[model samples]
Target chain A: MNNALPRWVDYGLMPLISVIVAFVISGLVVLFVGESPVQAALLMAKGAFGSGYNIGFTLFYATTFIFTGLAVAVAFHAGLFNIGGEGQAYVGGLGVALVCLSLDSVFPWWITFPFAIIAGALFGALWAFIPAILQAKRGSHIVITTIMFNFIASALMVYLLAGPLQKSANLGPRSRDFAEGGQIPKLGGLFRPLGIDMGASPLNVSFALALIMALVVWIIIWRTRFGYEMRTLGISPRAARYAGMSEVRLVVLAMMLSGALAGMMALNPVMGDQARLQLDFVEGAGFVGIAVALMGRSHPAGIVPAAILFGGLYQGGSELAFDMPNITRDMIVLIQGLVILFAGAMGSLFTPAIVRLLTGVGVMPK
Target chain B: METILQLLDLTVRSAVPLLLACLAGLYSERSGIVDIGLEGKMLGGAFAAAAAAAVTGSVWLGLLAGIFVSVLLALVHGFASITNKGNQIVSGVAINFIAAGAAALLGNAWFNQGGRTPQLQSEQRFNPIELPLAETLSSVPVLGPTYQQLISGHNLIAYFAFAMVPITWWVLFRTRFGLRLRAVGENPAAVDTAGISVSWARYRAVICCGILCGIAGAYLSIGVSAGFVKDMTAGRGFIALAALIFAKWRPVSAMWACLLFGFLGAIEIRYQGVALPVLGVVPVQLMQALPYILTVVLLAGFIGKAIPPRAGGVPYTKER
Candidate 1:
């Protein structure tokens, strides 16, 4: 029985337990809001997966989060909290849109897409490198600097949207739409040969790209000399320095890679699907990725499931609200909050007891 | 000069909530609990106060409720950080996200005003109190004007906020409990060896933070405005944190830091309509970005020397 408890609490059930706790806490919120929790859950399920279109929309949502989650997890492995994902993504989208607008007629679709991706990655790398260099050279705290970067990016984007990038035709504060050639093709028609039309979901080739990127991250993190250096530095910077690893270079490189992954998210939704960079292109996907990264326990592969779950919440919550009057889109935000709270608290809530139980046995080293 | 005096008055009024929050941060952080969740606790208190006032038509009771809920969150934070030895930053982040989401959720249900509460009447909110002594002192000179403008025409909460600075300094330095608390923050092992529980001292500090943050939040919704808005604390918690660092964890200096930021905020808001002819139209975005720009510059320059406690983020685990 003692060993059973430890076995039962393995990594497999971690996300499950986290989800259960999230549901319970969010259920209380629903009760407070005077809505039946069961009905709300049912509606969310129906909205998220009722039709093939809903499932496709869910995949579209997942694609962006997966990139962001990977970005966050990469930094987490290197012992950095890059909350500047939002800023990086914003800049990346802007860079891509600028590229698309300037080169739409000159370059073919293949060339233009590659150019947009490169622009995004470069801008994201530059955005992250500033704080990374500051932390490495000046002993500046990464968390504070990255958080400040988020605000700066928000203000910068707001200013640009309201002034320079303001669409001449639309009265609202949004940028002009990209040309038709920039839009990513839908996968439903391609899959229709096998009678697999996934309906109206925006899930595209980006989903496949996200999966490939996850594998690349996993390999880069686990099988390379740079990965070893990063893990060591994350655990102990002084130790890594003694081992001949350059803290300055590694910090900058880690942040660049992180930003590069985050930048790819812009390709998924903003550049690929929307074919334009509007003010709400990413729509807080960067911040939401933080919650996904935490719940995924900062693993590249682990983040895919976490991202999809959150994406489901977004897609489903929107659908539920459209179907029902009482349940609003804000419920999804509440659920995200609850999931983060539970996941953060989980380590403290059970780790000590589990440690004790496992240590007494032959299974664990004391 | 008249505009300067008016601006000074506005600065004092604006400085109140931030000053109180900085003191709250000072108390908790001095004892080793990094209370970044001050923003969340403040939101909780603000929402509670606004709702209670709207329903009961009693601002005093509403303010009391705000204090109570803020302290409750402080206790929760203390338990999580001190007792469970959880990550302080993560705990605070969760609290912030929870408060943000919860407030909006509840507001949607209760008011149906789209994530905001209904505006209460003037009588249902706290109003500024003008001093009778200001009339007699109006003729005294520049000093008289300074006193009248800076001190006499602020809400009750503003005056109370000023009083908290010295009170905080006294409690943090003069008292035995404060000494032990500071000791725990700097070196918990030493405090533990001295027969005091590190967890308990830290818990007490967090509770102090909660009460102060509650007052700060109440001042926002009741003393400053008539209603509660979604995410209305609006990065003020972070400003309080910056003020805490700029003061180098000293209560008295922290008060001055609050005033500096407060003055900046007041100027930004007041300068919106009344701009210099040469400058033309001043965008609200610039003003919104002002405090953040100031924070980045201040932290990057003059306050780089400020060091956090040695064990600020590391949780204390007692080996019994």
Candidate 2:
């Protein structure tokens, strides 16, 4: 069989096909739950794109997904799977909360935001450091260690939130609200000056920050010397060694960078939206990152669109649940799971058949 | 003394599911398929068992249904990893997500109780069975009371969990199927060349894994508690995987490791508000995190090296 298909077919067409298959399967699931799949689809599209408010919420979710998707993509480039993005984001939220609580009264929003970002990145990097070092030096697998850390991070967060961080006046397991100066301005306000009513949504300056981070990731991965070494290590560790690249250093650096990107995800939820630290702010965005990275083929250009698509699914799924009583939130999760299963695990299921067709048509170089 | 015995009982109670799941993982991973989907299978089983028992009012039927669903999931994993040559971990993660979502969706739709199945009646649940001579033995000294508290008065599944350790060891070491399974994990090509179909060996191993995980799930819903809860497995499957590694993939050692984790779990529950002598008010969260922390420490080679099967996680292709 000819294996000389164009890059677009390999990267673009395959993911598109997988996603369509997944949606068909999900539509069947919706039908199983006694709902009209067509109506659900229409409702979802409208919910995700109908009004400025809906679009704003979608962008807000997309922002977080972008950060996390980039996190997974960066690590994948180095041949590492960083499943601990959830934990890193959780700890990074803690970092943001700490910085906000301590400096909110003294510093302005601009001053505190940078400190919060640094702290979030540092804490996230620290969380990833142990697994990175283990993988680099001890030959221990990164997947297991990162998974364990996720659980540990949850427990630690529970402890902090319920014990020390809980407000004196409140009994809930959440930190007190941030000072006015520390809260990032919502994008809704920015749009007011342009005579466009974006409505009430969590969309904020962090969305722009997330885009900037994606650009930075692209430059670092494609242009920088460190990224070249990291890619070399991923492609062939022996070849990298022969070329005098330090595998250990590259592994650690790649993981730390991945964790930092994941940490930045907390900024959107905690600082930009919640204006306070809360349990489970990260939700399953970390896990969703894996699917986004897979569907995007681990490229920033691909991840941006993939993240937006997922964000639409999430926002629209909620609307479907609200409109249709039979379809619950869990049903939405089931659909997301099906999508992940197809796009990530069964991603190459149609590759061989497509290759055969493309070669038979003489579209590929034989 | 009584507190110690009660703690021991709680440890046994908690250890049963972990023991079963860890042994299940041992079967699949021993044959070269990394079964990280143990959690998902267990969740699927728990939901099936709970739903079936609620409708049928028969725990035995529920157990069968649970096993059926779990085996179906196992077949899905096998098809993806073995036939499609997909990434095992990704497949497992997907399975976890599917189980979590499907359980909630079905539970709410069927029962209309917000993603939770109806609570099982006494007749539909596994109740503790008192052993013969337990009343007479309770009057005796240490051994009798110890046996009465720790051994005699538990559900049937606990005994099955304990028995499975030796049974697994015997099957893996003494049986022909066991030899082929281990050989396939270490080197599938060599096993294939020896006229043993590697896929068949792996399929059998994964199926066995499903059965074990199904029992673990059933035990959680019908035996341990009354009905299913969302995310009830609650990362126990991952802990079981950790136990599998901690035991170096050995059955007997896996039991011991699971027991240790169970003890930790029991301690966390029993000493929620108690202050210890040296530690002074040991936080429940810290205790909850201990098992994972220890797993990380072990994986980092702080305890000992855990070398996986040589051919593990690599899809076997004949042409390659």
Off by over 4 Å in 2: A1-3, A190-196, A360-362
Tell me the tens digit of each residue's lDDT in model 2 across B1-320: 79999999999999999999999999999899987899999999999999999999999999999999999988888888888778888888888888888888888777888878898998898889899998888878898889899998889888999999999999999999999999999999999888878898999999999999999999999998999988899999999999999999999999999999999999999999898888899889999999999988988898988888888888888854
Q: Please give the CA lDDT of all the candidate structures.
A: 0.80, 0.89
Candidate 1 lDDT by residue in tens digits, A202-300: 888778878999999999999999988998999898899899999999999999999988887888877667766677677878878878888887887
- Give the range of the ten consecutive residues with the poorest summed lDDT in model 1 chain B: B295-304
Cα deviation of B88, candidate 2, in Å: 1.2
Over 4 Å off, model 1? A1-10, A191-199, A352-366, B135-149, B273-287, B301-304
The number of clashing residue pairs in each candidate reads 0, 0
How does model 1 score on DockQ?
A: 0.50
Output the number of the lDDT-best candidate. Answer: 2
Q: Pick the TM-score winner.
A: 2
**Candidate 2: how close is chain B to the reference, as a TM-score?**
0.99
